[model samples]
Target: MIVSTNDGQFDQLIDDLSRLPTYTIGRATTNSIVVANGKISGQHARLIQCTPTCFIFEDLSSKNGSFVNEVRIARKVVDKQDTLRLADTTFDIDTLLALLKAEPVKAEKPVPPVSITPKLLSEVESNSLNFTEEFADLKQVYEQYPKLRKDCRNREKMIRTGSVILSSIVSISAVVSTGGAALPLLHVLSGAGLSVLIPTLCSTLLSTEEKLEVIDKEYRERYRCPNPACRDPFGTREWELLAQQKTCRRCQAIWVQ
Candidate 1:
């Protein structure tokens, strides 16, 4: 049975589900049951005795999230005892059965069995046996302190070089303008001041080894997993853990790091 939140387009949702061939259970039509506030609204659980062996519930992409039992479920199949939450309403198995009670049972033909070829089965087995291990090398690379230190040094050097260039320009201008002057010394004084200021400004602009260390520390702290299932938090050390990891130690949840 397809169920969704009654967000003004109830008729449209019913129409869409009714069009599907799998929806026909006995002679019951789409209008056999009605949905209200995410629940069955008026039916009893005994009605589900006439329900088809298999049923599908589409989310209809409601505004609020959907939950099966207490866990949030993405678009997928559901089973008995699963409680669905749509917006603010909750529909348990009993509620679903109750709603189905109002609909008349219709005769349905048995579905044909699907067959799989030997070639397809072999292909699936072959593909399933192969597992990629690219992330292992990547993890080792990130663990190396030398690479991180070198990166930090390179960044610091670039900033220092820019500072030196700005200071040199200021110093040269000061020397040239003050070559023979004592009275009109303001230009030289200004240039000398600028030379120191420029270097200081460049140094301030560039990130040093100490700053990078701090950034790394903060990143590790933020990304670290306190959960036992996902102990190794630094799965993707690239740019705040961008890579994917097959397993999380603290949570044991496989995900892209």
Candidate 2:
């Protein structure tokens, strides 16, 4: 289960909710999930385990009320995929369960601080520089390269959409602020300045070609054989083709399923 805290951050992770037959969610200390938000009543809601894969959400007549997919409900049968809201905080049950099933992260030891001179920094940089364009496992490339491509596409789309919205807002605001009224010279100058700034900001935003160039650079940096010792660039090679090949040309790393 996932719980949103009082600070409006949904960082709390409950690995499993099935452990308990019934779990209470409220602002009170005795509840299973004690959310300290004012919207939540002292005894807000409870989840009663009905079956292995099903649970019943019972709202305790909260002031702000409980919701299942935005509809306020007193009692409802909920599955993992249901969207649950207790007062103001909302959480996806499927997302929470998915997070629980995801691979656990290993704890890392803290690294000690290092005091470095220019010579030491130079030596460190030289030692850390990887000449080979390969990883130790082809699986890494198979998994990560597609995600990189998707991220690039998403970023490009976001930038384009944002640029349009930003330019439109600036243009509209500049027009609306004037309101056809005879403004002071300073106000007119300010409006003119905003007009000048609109194009400048729009021009600064990366074009599709520039975004593609960045993507290409990123692709060159990362789309290599999954062998740290011999990272050969798989230039313009389709992932399917690489998978069919089964092994890296440079590193001989097996691309096992």
TM-score of each: 0.23, 0.30
Per-residue lDDT of candidate 2, residues 43-139 (tens digit): 8988754323345678998999999999999887676667999888997654323422236789999999999999999997655533222232333
CA RMSD per model (angstroms): 27.7, 25.5
True-structure Cα RMSD, model 2: 25.5
lDDT of 1: 0.36
lDDT of each: 0.36, 0.50
Segments in model 2 whose C-alpha atoms lie over 4 Å from true places: 1-20, 94-257
Worst 10 residues of 2 by lDDT: 9-18
Give the clashing pairs for model 2.
Answer: 133-231, 134-227, 134-228, 134-231, 135-226, 135-227, 135-228
Off by over 4 Å in 1: 1-32, 38-54, 101-257
Total colliding residue pairs, candidate 2: 7
Clashing pairs counted in every model: 21, 7
